[model samples]
Target: MPKKKSTFFNSVRFRIMAIMIVLGIVPSLVIAKAVIHSYEKRAVSLRISNVRNQCDILCNQLVGVGYLENPSSKVIERQLEVLSNVYSGRILVINHSFKIIKDTYGLDEGKTVIAADVIRCLQGEVTSDYNKKNKYIELTVPIKDPEQQEQQGVMLISISTGEIASSVELLERNGMFFWAIIAVAVVLISYMASRVLVKPFNKITKAIEEITDGYQKEDILVEDYTETELITDAFNKMLNRMKILDESRQEFVSNVSHELKTPMTSMKVLADSLVGQQGVPEELYQEFLQDITMEIDRENKIITDLLSLVKLDKKASDLRVEHLHIDDLLELILKRLRPIADKRNIDLILDCFRPVEADVDEVKFTLAISNLVENGIKYNVDDGWVRVSLDADHKYFYVMVADSGMGIPEESLERIFERFYRVDKSHSREIGGTGLGLSIARSSVLMHHGTLNVSSKEEEGTTFTVRIPLSYIP
Candidate 1:
């Protein structure tokens, strides 16, 4: 038994399923990441705006109450502390001299704190910076003297982004769980869809298998897809062709048996007559011997024709192709068969339209054309004409043999090329025909990758046309 293929990885179903899974999962991951990052950004912006507004209000109060110079106000200190605690951050109030007047954490109150953000704020610029890695939003808000409209101090604050981080982490966990469910659903759906899509092919395979095992003889129909329909149609055509070939083979064998036996039976009867006689006359003996010899010759002709057919049935590679003048070839063929035509007083004629050359197997091509020409002559009326014509074009040359003879019946025309098939069996036998001439001729033309076609009408005439390419293809 042949080794079975890996069911999942090696199959079309697996590839389709894998593509679906990737399609389903990749986009989900991208959208989830984008949503989470957007949330983090929005939350940070809102937190920064809220804290900055509160700082602005406090700085206005400090300027109005003269608290920067006083350094001690119960209301201002309480408000600053409440703002710091609300956002989980630290605040620093700096004077014009860059001294920390009040630190919400109470650690840097006596220190001289000089930072880039603090200096920028004192120059009347409000600035904010976000540190994603540190998870904080830093801001610097300027405090100004209202009457002079000049900078007095700066309020610098750093707010923690711990809440945003926690929210993002939670969203990520939920998204992962949701994506897992969707991934499972997609895999299941894709697997089933793949199987459904491939079902028709499986049916076609099963139908072929049943035919191979001799369990079924009917043609298959798979219309699930256009492709499947096309495949089924092609297979049916091939199956029908095989059936026809098989029937032809059987018919050919049966005809061979009957034809071979007829000559043998005739010879046996002639021989038995002489043997059973006590005193046979010398003239009578000669006649019996002559009859016996005639039967033997007929049998030999049948065998020879059969052998020729068998060789023609062999591969085309057996042909020894050569370049030859087609007009000259036809003339030579007609020359050889002129005596036979003359015996019946049939006017044998050859008409060449133009000089032509072609690649052909010289012996096989000659045999095929010779058979056609001979048939024209043998089946012609006494004193009637048989015309053999040769014509050529750029790519192909044509040979046509037309005879004014007893034409074939329309019904028998189709089967004329079948081995041992005869239009008129009695007439064919009288003319020493083995009924294999047309079949051999056709096979020879086919071997050279050419075509032989015949057209006829009863009691009128018959014409055989052979078309061969100027250059042999294979």
Candidate 2:
């Protein structure tokens, strides 16, 4: 017994959905990281700019109020406290001598400044630092004495990066949540798409399974699936071919049964006539024996033809191929069959195209041609004519045999080469013809990689044409 097939995850729909999920997740995560990074950088830069502008405004105000000569620490401290409260950032004032004069947090009132941005500001230049020990945007703006037109000191500002970092972390968390939602949506959409895409294939698979279970006529029905039309077309073509093969198989069985039954019936009748208790005369016994012998020969011929067909089917590739003159070969075959033709008063004629040659197996090629010639003679009226001719072109060699015989019906011409198909059953049996002759002839011609065709009209005549490719010569 065959094992049952497993269905868990065995469908194309599931596999396609899995593949899409795996391929889409990584790139989405990378894009989310980049977006978060860009937002954080912009936030930090904006905070730094705002703090710098506030410090510039305070320095200008102090100079305008005539407090630059030696501004008291308490007055500077008051200004710094108001600005720091408004901007939410630390403020520091450093003098030209690099001394901290005022600080909003009041951490260093008399200490010398060592910060890089403060040192540059004391030298009459504006500077800023982003990466500093204070984790802030540190900036310095030069303080000029308005009446002297010279720098008296610099104002330093430090804005904390904590707000930027906090916003960035929040945005990143929200982005993660959004990405999770997107991933789930993607998987659901992929699963839906895969289900739609594989629906037709599932139908086809079911049809095939039905065929496997002996429902040979089942068909896959799909509508308007343009994307998979090629697959559908190929599958339909294969099924059509299988249908033809099945029909041929049934016909073969029928033909074999009929062919075997006829001879067995004949033998049984002849045996009964000879062995019946009514005493038989010597002359009648001889006739009954002859009848039995004929039937036995007919049975043997059928079996021989069947065995030959089997061998040809199996060993066609093993035939010996060689270059031989077709004219000489035909002449030899005709000479051998001439005695039979003479006995029937049939006129045998040959129209030889000189030096016609082809690549073919000698024995098989002769057998095919001999069968055609014999068929012509066997079917012809006494003293009727049979003509054999050779025609050739650059690419092909043709052997045609025409006989003035009881020609086949137009409808039966095509099936004449089918095993056990006889157009004139009574005539065939009268002439001791086993219906396998044309079938064997066709198979032999096919073994040489050639074609054999017949044309006939009732009561007129029949012509058999055999074409062999010249280039196929060894």
Candidate 3:
């Protein structure tokens, strides 16, 4: 099978750059087109206005001298010369008969003009139009004799309009240059902005990579990054969670190894004793068999505890729920653990203040409460007291088991409910505890959406409180 190649344009950086180009380029082109069109229109209108004004002034000068019928050619030539010098183009004056009366370029004298605009002006309509053939603007103003109250002849003026085209071309060139500068500046700014945006993401990625490589102790530090603080905070929180989970995994492995080793070591010792060279006595062999049986029993307890913990981690919907009287349940659990209490010489006291009821899985709840009561009696001093009490608040029932035995340290209090965690490892093993008692108890309580908490002071006593909410009860 061949590997597929990824397209570079699919990357985020490429997409961002593409967006900037589209946003920057389209508007620049539109603005350039508009500016060129506006400048061209204004230039043509101003040139035509200037030529019309000049022709009107020349006609007025001729009429004032009463020489409108046969104006001197020298006079018209002088007027055309003045206008041509003021404007940057040639000017021509023609009559209503389309005959050239005066020419600033000195080439149209006594010539009959056959232009469309000139023919229109000869019909007595005022005209200001462009001649595309010669690139000139032609304007015609009607000459009137005030004494006769009638129209005389047309005063036509023509000027080159190529200057308007040149001005529009210059504007377009400048617009292109300005947009080029803007594009360069925008590209630089986009690059800098993308870098600033991706910096925090890079830091997060590097931190994750370090974690994958088993370097999880480092904390993420990004400065001057207020815009990405939320993302950074979430990343840091995930890292902290992973660190805690890693520690938990290591502790579970260590605890399992220790639990398994004790039983296997005992089995090995017993088997060796039974097969020793000194022919094994029957009674001693029975003792060895009893030891093996006890170790097997311990292993069975550890396996049972592990299975219960797994079940508790599953969804509550999987467990069969039923309504049971809290007082009745406690009575049954204490009765079942009474023999252990008797063997240890510990007094199991029950203080029931209310007949509280809750809905929960009966078998799991019984096992959890049994473990707590048994632990209280098993670890207590001779004649020590284990108190089981029940109380109810507005929305929950509280079951508290307090024992006057070797109490836990304040620092280790929270970790007591962790799997296979024991305050005194040697003492727990001597008492035949699988060290998963409190963990199972906590999980069972959580299945009912309840909370399990413990408070203890070393050498004083320990109190385990289980609060079950009424909402969780059917």
Candidate 4:
């Protein structure tokens, strides 16, 4: 269960769901809040306007009928009572002397009322205010004498906001209920959307799991999105490469077993023949021993070449690098293989375009170049020429080994660097070739971050070019 929770939190689906929820719900909530506050503000403004209009009418009547001077009008008094009852508020009608002539509540009649709103209204400026905490609206309206163009008195009104408060409460409750439904809908939609979006990735995962579990080796197709298509292509390429490597490993093991067993079998046969003989001739016995010894030597050579290939295949960090003159290096390699070339009556030549220096592992570099030059001599026609050339640019040094030899077949050129691959098997065996020289040489060049390429034509000749960086990176 804990693992499942961790997986969910880390998954793309959860992130998508979270993003959708935030996008869908947060803005609606903000707008809803703004809308509620706006309604309240607009409602208060309209309420204040209506009350002010009524007060203005009453103030006009007071001045026209001379009601403030008389103070005994039952009609005006009843009207004031009705207005106060309708609005559930208090109203005070004051004279120019600041003496209240009529108080609807009858609590402050004949008394002086001194307030900033009233004083301001008496000076021809109407004033109004709302106290949110107290839930009330307060305002003062002026009584003006029209012909005189002067202010007579101020009528102060304080109205209860309980009605607006009730409406706001109802709106808030309804809003909460509406948002509850919206929140649930948002969550459901986000969850469904996330699941739909991640479906292709889940399919890709299942396909990969099947491959890793050894249940399937076929390529997968998930083109629901462009990203999924790219992933599918990359995965299929990796799977195909793994398949090729697996096949190569199995073939290598089989080849190693066969090659190792053949020499042993021959030696066993030679030993058994000597043991089975009652009276073998000294000369024949010596000949049989020589044959057995040759098989043993062949087996040893195969083992040695295999070990060299293994070492070359190791990490490039194992290289013991040093700067050496590349032209001189090529000269020394040719000198070492000159004896073999002389035995075959092959001319070994070295040409240096200019003196060059490069960082290299001397032992591995020598082995790689010697194999090329020796192969040139070993596979050449009688009295054929083998030329070793050296050249250099700013970044890299180049070596070319060209020989007048029975060149490689077109099909065999590609597999020449593969282990135990030989172009002419019979001739290779006759010349004591173990077929690992090219593979070892290729591995050595690769370790130094270089490339070895070959071009040849049948019964004509072959040319091998080696390029290595002047400086070793590692």
Candidate 5:
């Protein structure tokens, strides 16, 4: 239970609730304090006013009877008693000599109360004090003869605030009650707001989970919000890429199985032919053995090409880059394949507009260029020619291999770079082609941040263009 509660406080809901509480409560506390303080001041003010009015009246009656001249009079005592009862506090009457002429409480009668306020009252001033914490009101007013315009005596009053103190406390309690209700409302609002905000994300998570579990077939739909839409779009794109990779992997496995099986099947048939033919002619046996060896070599080449493709597909594969003459590279590739070209009487030519130097993977680029030129020679007609061209600009070097071969069909051009894709399966097998040559060539060129392009006409010829940066960037 404590674990769940701990998680809840760490969750978005709690953080949002905490924020709302601070936003709602800090100001409320300050406002309540101000209100209580103002009530305290107003309570003191009202008591002072009430006592002032009663004291003024008593002072007038005393002046009319000349009570200060005779403090022991019964009439003045009765008036003082009435003033004390009405105001609910102490009352003291002081003469101009700063002597307590009359005291309603009688505790300070005949005492000389020579206080600052008493002296100020003797000089014809009124003063009041209010103690908010203790809750009391004190006031002093001077008695004056209107005709002579001189101070005759002073009236001082003190009032208890028992009712006001109790009322202020009750106000605080009621304010706190209202605040409690407000806090509950804020909690509910924050909870609902956080829930509403998080609903889309929850839906997204559920949809992704379904996709992961193979239950969902369609892209996640959460376009009600921009942020969620962006998340959904990115996730769906990555999902689609994974799907493509999975399909490609399955296809690759099938193709590899089929390709490997074919060579083994051919070797098996050749072995069976030797086994059945007892005392076979030496020349015939040699031919069969050569055929078996060729098939084995073909199998090895296919495996090698597959490994190369896998390396090229990786993001972190490093290139052994070197600055070498592009012209020399092409000559080296053609030199190796020239004998095969000679067997077909196909003309092999190098049309170098200018010698080009580029930073490239020495062995990989030679293999890639060899694939292009070798294909040209292998697929060309007898007495036809294969032309290799090297050209360059400030930024990039270009290699073009144009051939007088039976070119690829227009529709098949795009799929030519796919693994094990062949336009003419019979001719490909006859030429011992694994159909991965173009794919490897393209991958190698692209690894150097280059481009491989082809333009061909069916039954006429084909031209391959290779563009590579003059200097490798990485």
Candidate 6:
């Protein structure tokens, strides 16, 4: 069983659920709080307004009956008694002297009610308050005397606010219940959405797992989303490249074994023939030793070429770069290979259009151009001409090698640079060719970020073009 990580808080579903909860619950709570506060404020304002209106009506009646001027009137006392009872709180009537004329509760009837609210009301100001914790609304209104054209006294009324408080509490409970339901719905939706989003990734995991277990070499054909498609495309390309490299490696090993064993077997047979002979002639002995020496040289040449190709195939980070002349480099390669060409009577020619200076690893570049020119001389018919040309544009310098050789066929052009690939196997072996020269040359040029191309026609001629940047980046 696979080990499980502490990933519940890290998973997609959990994260989505967390986001939904924040979206659903936080806003719901804020709106609920705002609504409750608004309702409470409105209810208190309505209660205070009602008390103010009730106090105004009673104050008008007191003024009409001349109650404040003569407070001992039985009719005024009865009216005040009824008003306080109906409003459900005590009422105080204070005159301009700030003395309580009559208290509906009968306790502060003959006492002075000197309060800030009462003083303000006597000066024609109205003030009110609702004490939510104590459950009461207080309002002080002016008692106007029409004859005096001013407030003659103040009427203070205090009423209970239990009903509005009870109703608001009920509404808050209902809002919370509705929000609870919405939060649950958010959780369910987030879970389903996360599942849908993560399904493709789960399938991709399975595909990779199968590959890891050494099961399939097929491309993962997932086309669910654009991101997944890009991933699959890149992964399939990498997989194809790895397979090609692996196959190439295996074929190279098989070819090396066969090639190395052939010469060794010949040497062993020749040695055994000498050993079995009682009196081997001096001439025979000399000939056998030369043959063995030739085979040894051939084997050593193959190993040396293989090593050079291996080194050339490495990354360009190892290049020993310096400023070199393109013309000089080409001249050096042709000058060295001219002696070999002279033996076969193949004329070697060089054409320089302009003198170009470039930043390149001189040794690697020289080896690469030498391989091309050498092949041109080796593969050509007797007395054929080999031409080397150098030209450059603003961006890149070019070298073209044209030879009147037995040219390559159309189909074999592409594979000609592949390692150990030979057009004529017998002729290649007879000419002491190890079949790694072109491959090494191409790799070396490519390491310098260059392009090498070939165009040829059978029995007519062949031309090779090499393009290299004037500057080396790395």
- Which scores higher on TM-score, 1 or 3? 1
- Pick out the ten consecutive residues of candidate 1 with the lowest summed lDDT: 211-220
What value of lDDT does candidate 1 attain over all alpha carbons?
0.90
lDDT of 4 by residue, 1-474 (tens): 355555888999999999999988888788788888899999999999999999889888888888878978888888888888888999999988999999999899999988878888888888889887889999998888878978888889999998898898888888888888898999999999999999999999998998888935689999999999999999999889888899999998899888899889999999999999889989989999999999999999899999998898788889999999988888888888888888879999999999999999999999999999988998899999999999999999999999999999998999999899987888788888788999999999998999999999988999999999999998
Model 6, 337-375: lDDT tens per residue? 889999999999999999989988888889888889989
Candidate 5 clashes: the total is 0
For model 2, the stretches where C-alpha displacement exceeds 4 angstroms are: 1-15, 22-31, 65-67, 81-129, 132-134, 142-153, 188-196, 227-230, 457-460
Q: Stretches of candidate 5 above 4 Å error?
A: 1-10, 85-88, 107-126, 145-151, 173-199, 215-217, 222-226, 273-290, 353-355
Ranking by TM-score: 4, 1, 5, 2, 6, 3
Work out the TM-score per prediction: 0.85, 0.83, 0.72, 0.90, 0.85, 0.80
> Candidate 1 residues 171-241, lDDT tens each?
99999999899889998999899999889999999999888888348898999999999999999999988
- Estimate the overall C-alpha local distance difference test score of candidate 2: 0.81
Runs with alpha carbons beyond 4 Å of true place in candidate 4: 1-8, 123-125, 145-150, 272-280
At residue 442, give the lDDT of candidate 5: 92
Among these predictions, the greatest TM-score belongs to 4
RMSD of each: 3.7, 4.3, 6.4, 3.2, 4.1, 4.7
Worst 10 residues of 5 by lDDT: 1-10
lDDT of 5 at 200: 89
lDDT (tens digit, per residue) of candidate 3 on 292-377: 99999998889888888878888878768778898998998998888888886889999999788777788888877888888788
Model 2: lowest-lDDT 10 consecutive positions: 215-224
lDDT of predicted model 3: 0.78
CA error at residue 415 for candidate 6, angstroms: 1.8
Clash statistics: count for each candidate:
0, 0, 0, 0, 0, 0
Encode model 5's per-residue lDDT on 81-175: one tens digit a residue.
87677666788888887788777787888888878888877776789987767767778987877667788888888877778889988999998
Global lDDT scores for all candidate models? 0.90, 0.81, 0.78, 0.90, 0.87, 0.87
